[model samples]
Target: MSFIPRRPPRHLLRLLVLLAVAALLYFYSAPVFNAAARSLIRVDAPAPADVVIALGGDARCMRERRAAEIFNRGLARHVIVSGVPYAWGVHTGDAAKRYVESLGVPAERITVLRDAWNTRREAMDVNELMRAQGWNRAILVTSPFHSRRAHYTFRRYAAEYTFISMPLEPEPPEWQPERWWSRRGDLGITVREYLSWINTLAGGWR
Candidate 1:
């Protein structure tokens, strides 16, 4: 009787190498991606402010609803719905304001600015309004992915007042925060947001 050693299969070796590469990629990339996502989202609105600002572009009205909630909680004396017209020519700012008003916010306490076609312009418009109204701070509401860029843009334009950014939670079908890399749409969103942030830092907000 003779004892013989068996060689490992080539497929098994290939699989092990692939797994090592995957683990390395995950270890290096996951933290950076998660950091970017976390940085974009600001959940704490611990203090009150002069007004609640619902940023434009989100037709889902998620931010508007959050702003309404903040207003209901007496975190702000006013709500400024900021956005331009949507694809169907409906003024988003007015639409958001109407929605908030229907939620029990007083009409007088809500201001609709339909001239802000983009985030930079919205920041400028809100900044001017804040100056005119002598508002010292604002509770800024926006999507979780957009909050960081929105904060940067607003701060660039309105450095005089404080902006407490409140980001809406990532909703399913549009975003998956826990498994953000599982969908192409989420990857696109994450990349776009990061690029936008970079562009803002590069003076694109000007």
Candidate 2:
């Protein structure tokens, strides 16, 4: 007696293929997500501007350092530090001003705006300051993750002046984007940045 062999079910074949694909993705998705995480960074070329504004929340003082560098390079004539009070009630704008000053930025060249509690408020207040000062162009300095949103918010709120986005290059080890997912803090920052982007797109923080 001869026995007939039956073919495997189509659903089983499809499931096998899906499993193979999933395995491949699971093994090789690092670069893909790394690139996705890097997409949040937007650094524009440094250009001569009337002023360089460093947004607040930089405990590491990286943003202030960049502002001072830009000023020292003559890319901007003035440096504006914009931020609200810190946890200890010390104004971030004031702290940033001192940081940049210590970095060799002259005291006469620094202006501090302490009323901005968030990026949106920063943009508004900075724009008003620029308008009053007759400044028509600005360079924005911020951390890598915050650059894109900061630039977008500033441009949205302050449409009259030209704004350039410059994220801190060669970011500190703690904020490295090459493997942001490996560290809990970096991962949280990346996720929060995207969420902030959504908020920015939806008319920004109220």
Top of the candidates by TM-score? 2
Candidate 1 structure quality by residue, lDDT tens digits, 162-198: 9998878777644545557768888788878878877
- Stretches of candidate 2 off by over 4 Å are 1-7, 87-89
Q: Global CA lDDT of candidate 1, please?
A: 0.83
Clash count, one per candidate: 0, 0
Instruction: State each model's C-alpha RMSD to the native.
Output: 4.8, 2.1
Q: Give lDDT: candidate 1, residue 106.
A: 94
Lowest summed lDDT over 10 consecutive residues: which window, candidate 2? 167-176
What TM-score quantifies how close candidate 2 is to the native fold?
A: 0.90
lDDT of each: 0.83, 0.86
- Please, what's the RMSD in Å of model 2? 2.1
In the predicted model 1, the residue pairs found to clash are none
